[model samples]
Target: MSAAPHIPVLLRPLLTACAPVRGTWVDGTFGAGGYARGLIEAGAAKVIGIDRDPLAHRMAEEWLPGFHGTIVLREGTFSELDRIAADAGAEQVAGVVLDLGISSMQIDIAERGFSFQKDAPLDMRMSQSGESARDIVNGADEGTLADILYLYGEERASRRIARAIVAARPVDTTLALAEIVARCLPRQKPGEKHPATRTFQALRIAVNDEYGELAQGLEAAERALAPGGLLAVVSFHSVEDRMVKRFLQLRAGRMGQGSRYAPLAEAEAPAFEAVTKKAIEPDAEELASNPRARSAKLRVARRTAAPAGRVSEQEIGMPILNTSRTTGGGRPRR
Candidate 1:
């Protein structure tokens, strides 16, 4: 039997890229404890699992004991992973692994509101308690809603979808909002994702502050890692992949030599070195077993003795919402 209820997106390649995993490691997005368990089984002496969702911790109670003392669960966002690990007595860790975005388990649950296919409350709160997708869909102004869809989800019909949603105020449930957004776009064709996919994804990302969390979480991992420690991330979308790529590039002192569009900056000691020169994708065999891995991308880096530093959100290609047009549901994490 598998240790995790569902296999994570890119376990094989992630493990391969982060080979010889040992010592203490932080599974920053410990959804369902899959990656945490994977790290322990991959030769880590201990794994500190961090998650924002209560559901993940609740489900972990069943199997965590089986691992004896190998897995330690901490309930919090990955953005605070470094502090959380230090509090747990691990000042620095051997590796940090993050499986970004909503887990498959969250989407499978009908009431989580992560899945547009499910007719449930529009509550895409990873922590299960906060301003939910319901609040954003119903409360955010049309322009704010449009910006979220456009910037976060890359939805070209964001304006039309936002207008339709405002016309259908109090979008009470997942399906209700999905239906409204779908009406503003072309009907789905064979093999194409549902029309509401982008809109729902946009709102969920907004509700969860996923991009901000990701940007902060990467830095946290850098700070929490000891010299030679590994940082591996699996991202499911283009925007996320781009962010990770840029962060690693900038940190590893591989920022392209003066691209005409990019501003030059003084170089400092590199904090990390790339372990995987290119992003790894699932093989055909794994894709056959888990179709969800089709879009997954894995990147790995190793920490250096150099001090960890910051990267501008712009440097990493994080989508910045126009503050003037922004309103509820997408507030930056405090």
Candidate 2:
């Protein structure tokens, strides 16, 4: 509503990769409706925009009306996108676009507590209702916290950071928890990301169950698309990009063999044909204009007539925490 502060990363590359973007499309992470609006303007007859965040729907009230009925906003996660599309009279959409990870809009707002830069409450719930960072930071066992940081954020100093976090009990604010994390590692240098970056990213991912949602959502997109329909995903980190890349590559039968868990199963036809043999990155112009686009990578594929198939969590390289992830203040056993 406030003029789309978030820029749709890799828009030009994504659009160019998905040229002739006609028919109904699904913008799964419809942060500020930038991708939805872009699709509609590029040629989509209608776009069923879906986002788990209620804030997105509320913020869209002012601008969505202007698009008339071309843009329909839905309050739900992309994991249920197939059902949402079916219910919206789009049983098989022409395309699906998912921008993975936290939205810039969420990080920009001080109260969201997504950014380590701001001194806000440690609340980083994407849906605005759930166990927040404060709950995890002040509660989760040291081992659990370590696993989360290591697996989710790929932080090497996860154990040390987790130890510090558990020692500094009752960390209430973003900056407070950040300070504790920063102390566990070397100080930040000029041009280097803050020491708390990985820790914060890990907590956000765990709190939101992003990797799990991503796996399910990818399968859901596979189910929701018609033959020849396009699927475009833009990821900001190595782990997420790896998951997307592996999912598409495996589904396209380019993984050289079937998933280890399903190696004995009958040969299934490739469900998708890779459109972009390699991931598309943002141009220098876009990166210069929006520094946030620096890490963005886009991958596009076209659905085939093959039945929607399953890909094991292991096949896509999704990081799985062996320990329990339930929210609590339980102390870690030695």
Candidate 3:
């Protein structure tokens, strides 16, 4: 199937924040190559486009060659973006751009199982390998399912929905699971989102280990970027946005002490400076062109000269769950 055309969310603001975008840059989540193309067109000497999904590479084959080696397409996760950049002959990149969440291509494809709007096999693996949503739905215990729904999707009726899922075991299709979840919630009103939306989001996040990857990817960007390098991330949901916001704040030395009663501890040298103190959202024109950009937010920061360091998962509010049984799923081992 031909890939759907994608409008890269927050592209305008991202380019503006990282202006004079010379030198090598890494498009960490290079879905549809939108950000990579934008970077190259906006003055980046080279763009290393990295994506875990094989479909992304396949789609790029048709158009990436036209760039004449300005854009190097690599099939890999952004969690190891530093390694990917170094292997591509760039030890330190000038910028890193990550668009968090599923790409339009994946969501629009019914067989990929990212959307509940279509009935297809329950597969949500971005890499097209490892445990799929079907495995988690059929194998995970009620408690694990509930935790995933609650922590990842922020669904208030996680337990109830999980119970319904358990009762309908061997659910192997996207619409089947969507129906089960919807049965547990109220009917959707005219403007309200579908009842199954949160459940589908939770399953997809678990199947792809998206939260874990996001945390590791941020650190990888920190290590890969040269001093004064830019890190621009566009997140589609609150959980993802909060994690990015907090990570940037902590790295920029904007984190506050516990309370007035507690003594202020010595702060480390800031590793980054905020390019945008607040998250940038799509303007009215962009929103009108693409309603999917409604929930998207862009946060940009510039790297300082300080050495790269580790960040605690708790500080970034990463969702924690026991994913030991699921192959290739869970937080990166420190």
Off by over 4 Å in 3: 257-265, 324-333
Off by over 4 Å in 2: 1-4, 258-265, 323-325, 328-334
Clashing residue pairs in candidate 3 are: none
Q: Per-residue lDDT of 1-334 in model 2, one digit per residue for the tens?
A: 2223888899988889999889999999999999999999899999999998888998999899899899999988898999999999999999999999998789888888888776889988898887888888877788888888899889999999889888888888889988998888887789999888998899888778788888999999999999999999999999999999999988988877646786755668999999998988888899898999999999999999999999988889988775456473221211
Question: Candidate 1: where is the Cα deviation over 4 Å?
Answer: 1-4, 256-265, 323-327
- Number of clashes recorded per candidate: 0, 0, 0
- For each of the candidates, the C-alpha root-mean-square deviation to the true structure, in angstroms, is 2.6, 3.4, 1.6
Q: lDDT tens string, model 3, 127-205?
A: 9998899988988888888888999999999999989998999899998998998889988789999898988899889
| TM-score of every prediction relative to native | 0.95, 0.94, 0.96
The stretch of ten residues in a row with the least summed lDDT in candidate 2 is 325-334
Task: lDDT winner between 2 and 3, please give it.
Answer: 3
- Window of ten residues with lowest summed lDDT in model 3: 325-334
Q: Please write out the lDDT profile of model 1 over residues 1-334, one tens digit for every residue.
A: 1222578888978888888878999998888887888888889999999998888888889899999989999989998999999999999999999999888888888888888776999898989887888887777788989999999999999999899999889788988988887788878799999998888888888888888888999999999999999999999999999999999999998886456788765778899999998999999999999988899999999999999899888889999876455555455533
